[model samples]
Each structure stands twice: as structure tokens, then as C-alpha cells.
Target: MASSINHHVMERAEFDRPVKILIVTSPYYKDIADEQVVGAKAEIEAAGGTWDVAEVPGALEIPTAIGIAERMSNFDGYVALGCVIRGETTHYDTVCNDSSRAITLLGLQGLCIGNGILTVENYEQARVRAEVAEQNKGGGAAAAALHLVALARKWGGPRKGVGFKPASDEIQIAGAAKGPNLA
Candidate 1:
């Protein structure tokens, strides 16, 4: 499913420049975040795009970094990678909801922000889903980001910095890749 989605193919001049993408991860679940990082890195490099990584305290900080990156105008796209497992209290809900909303806003700014955040019920679930070496969603998210860039460039032509097509105006993602999609 994920692997099959054709991330846009552009003409030589259309993509004359390899994209610059940012992958920011949270270390709250060190092992999981590490895996996501690896998957995303491999995919980005495989596609001939340049990726730079940034470390944050926890998943809560992911949106902030994204906001910073969004304002920078340096990166053509962003991959916000993190693992937030549900705990005994409502903390998980707060983190998940808040981060999700933030990512939505970021995407609306006309910049492609691929959300690879993992919200699970337990550590085991996180471990399995964050299959950095296998189905690392980080890689999936990176692929999405790049695809969006291809779309943006096509619709508006090239620009000096990141671009976005509003959520209301954006193309349907084909499937539920933005949700609990894992393939």
C-alpha cells in the first residue's frame, strides 16, 4: 500500500533541484524514535533528497520544532517523527491531540509536513509500529512530504522556499495514509 503510492515523477527541469527535508524526532522513546529516524533517513537518501535530523526532548516538542522549521524557509518539507504511547492518565490524549492539531496548522501554511507520529497504547505497540528497519513510518512520511512538494511545484511552479496547497484545496491523499495506516 504505502510502498505502491507513486510519489510524483517530474521532468528534469521540474525537479532540477533535489529537495531539502527535515526529520525531527523525540527521544522519549529512544529506541522507537531511533528506528523511525533510520527509516526516514534511508528513504530520503534513496530518493536523492537531502535530509537533516534534529533531536528534541519529547513528542511534545515535535510541533515546536516543526513550527521553527516551517518559518525557516530552508526545508522544502518536514517529517515530524515521534512515538507517544498511552499512559495511565490523560497525558497521552493531551499530547496526541495537541501535536496533531499543530501539525495540521503547519501543513496549512503551504509547506509539506509529513506526520510520522506514533500514538499507541503501550510500549510494545510502539515498538512494533515504529519498525524503523521494516515499515518505518518515518520513511513513509518523508515520501509523503516529497510527494506533496512535487504537487506544489506543479500547481504553482517553483519557488525560493517551501510551499503548500491549502488543506481545503489539497488533493485527497488517495488513502488513509495520514491515519493509522501501516502497510
Candidate 2:
């Protein structure tokens, strides 16, 4: 089975500066969410990083909170933690797909985010994944975010002006005296 294969777990990433990460979680499943937060916090602390926690109403709100924080706060990265167990209704599929998609879209937008939200068939599965002694998906997610932050630091900064460029005439230079004759 996939679980039987020996996998390399990277050592905690080191940061030259104090890396601050924001963790957004849904306490809908309190036990699962708490476990995830515990694991995430442990990983971040081990990596020489600091973190803040925020609680959202549900999984769907996790990304939204991150988005708001990305715009209004200065966190270096984000960790999303939640658990969505399958239900008898179609709501399960919608929650699972939409939440995952939102997290992916945010990552593609250049936000360093670790998605630890669990979409499982039952509480048992979530228990196994969320347990720090078992899979520890929470720690995995925090590690993922740290790795992305390290990569970003290695690259220095993001590319500037990727999509659009102004023409020569459209570029305005500062400190140059404007000619009075030019209308």
C-alpha cells in the first residue's frame, strides 16, 4: 500500500528571518481541527517560525479568511486546516471540490499556502490522518507552506510586470520638467 512505502520527510526548513504564518481552521469537527492545529503549530515552531491562528465557520470559509489576511496582513505564509466528512447528501462533493479549488487558486496566485483540510469518508479516516502520531497531515501541510516560503526566498522576489507593459510614450519619468508647449 501507499502507506507502506518509506517516504522521505524533509527536515524543518530554516529561515534567515522570522517567518510568520497564519493558520485558518474550521472547528466544525472540533477534535479533528484541534489536532491539526497542534501538529501545524509544532512544525512551525520547529522550523524557527511563528504563527497565528484564526477560526472560520466552515471549510468553505477557510480560503476566504486567508484571502483577506493576504490582502490586509503581513503573514509570510498560510495553513488551512479543516475536516469534511462525507454525508448522505451531495453537499459533501460540493464542499470538497470547492474548498480544494479555492486553495489551489490561491496558491497559483503566488500565495504560499499549505492545504491541510481533510476530505474523508468518515470520522475514522479523519482521525487517522489528523493524529500527530499517525499521518499528521497538519504537520505535512505546514511543511509544505514552509517549503514554498523557502523557495520564494531563494528566488529573491516574484517577477515584476509579467502580464502587461507600457509603451515608451506611456511611461512617465519623474523629476523631468514638462514642456509648456506640449498639450
> Lowest lDDT 10-mer window, candidate 2?
170-179
Estimated TM-score for each candidate? 0.75, 0.86
User: On residues 4-72, what C-alpha lDDT tens digit does candidate 2 reach at each position?
Assistant: 667899878889999999999999999999999999999999999999999999999999999999999
lDDT of every model, 2 decimals: 0.80, 0.93
Please tell me which predicted candidate would have the highest TM-score against the true structure.
2
**lDDT of each residue in 1-183, candidate 1, tens digit only:** 344555553432225578888998897889888888888887778778898999999877888997887776588888999998888999999999999898888788787888999998888777766786555677778777787777777887555657874555243564444675566
Could you tell me which 10 consecutive residues in candidate 1 have the lowest summed lDDT?
7-16
Q: Assess the local accuracy of residue 115 in candidate 1 as a C-alpha lDDT between 0 and 100.
A: 92
Please name the candidate that would achieve the greatest lDDT relative to the true structure.
Answer: 2
Give me the displacement of residue 60 in model 2, in angstroms. 0.4
Q: Model 1 lDDT vs. the true structure?
A: 0.80
